[model samples]
Target: MSIRHCYLQALALSTLLLFSGLSLALEKPIGPAVLRISGLVTQPNMLQQAVFDMQMLQALPQHSFTTQTPWYPEPVKFTGPLLRHVLAAAGSAGENITAIALNDYRTEIPFSDALKYELIVAILMNGQPMPVREKGPLFLVYPFDSQAELQAATFYNRSAWQLRALQIK
Candidate 1:
């Protein structure tokens, strides 16, 4: 009725829409789910896990870099959302992440890696989408060439490929 009431109503509606959008972001994947994040998270939608389709991850801010790795003979381009952004989207609040690959190869990645290193949840390699056989739909990659400290077996083993799930602990 009054101007104050109208303003309050508009604010309420906007707040409702904002929360609705967040809920929609966690909706079941339209295509196959590329990754699942579970444990120590604020949001869990699918079977107590946040399941992400390729498009969902792609929607985040993309980061790309070319670097050499033990697996590759030459510098290769890796592209995907930053690990921190992905964790934030999933509402992950943990000190460490246990990355599990398709082959059941698992590695523990410190949460600090997201801050200390420009880690990427790599969706593409060498400008091409990685097939499951080639270590894709997802890979956790560190910029080994960018930082000398990351060029060791410890960091190499922590770079999980064919990443299927992440459990925060």
Candidate 2:
């Protein structure tokens, strides 16, 4: 083959290989029972207390409570499913869980809290969705007012706000 033809052939072969690799990379990664709970409406069945998406969270029976946080001055109304419900959905029975936020912030919570305490994943506040600045979408909260033991700073730190993911390990 002439020099120009040889160069064209090599270019075509490289392009084919690149496209093939890109296709494979674009394929979804396997493993894990990934459930998306965002943009789904909350409902009011017994199962509603279990696994739920964001839209479902909004639709479910609403519970509102105003509480103060270190991040804010005035108390904020928190609404969402009980933490126990979320744990049950994940089939979690471990001692620790890693909660990740949309911004990649993460914290670890004791499994005992979910199993024994009335912690909640607050999806709303003051009858409105929680924006990122307001610690919205999802906020893990312990009944600090009801349970004095839960008012400690350690528990407060574990009460991750703006939560997006939960991995029980």
Which one is best on lDDT? 1
Task: Compose the digit string of candidate 2's lDDT tens values, residues 29-129.
Answer: 13321223221112212232223456544443445566676666777667776765544333334446777777778788876677576677887677777
Candidate 1: tens digits of C-alpha lDDT, residues 1-169: 4568545534443454355343324556788888999986656668778889998888877899999989988899999988877776676656689999999999999877976788999999988999998988899999998989999999999999999999987
True-structure lDDT of candidate 2: 0.57
Off by over 4 Å in 2: 1-52, 58-62
lDDT over C-alpha atoms for residue 62 of model 1 = 85
TM-score of each: 0.83, 0.63
- Candidate 2 TM-score versus the reference: 0.63
Off by over 4 Å in 1: 1-25
Residue 66 in candidate 2, Cα distance off native in Å: 3.1
Evaluate model 1: give its TM-score.
Answer: 0.83
Best by TM-score: 1
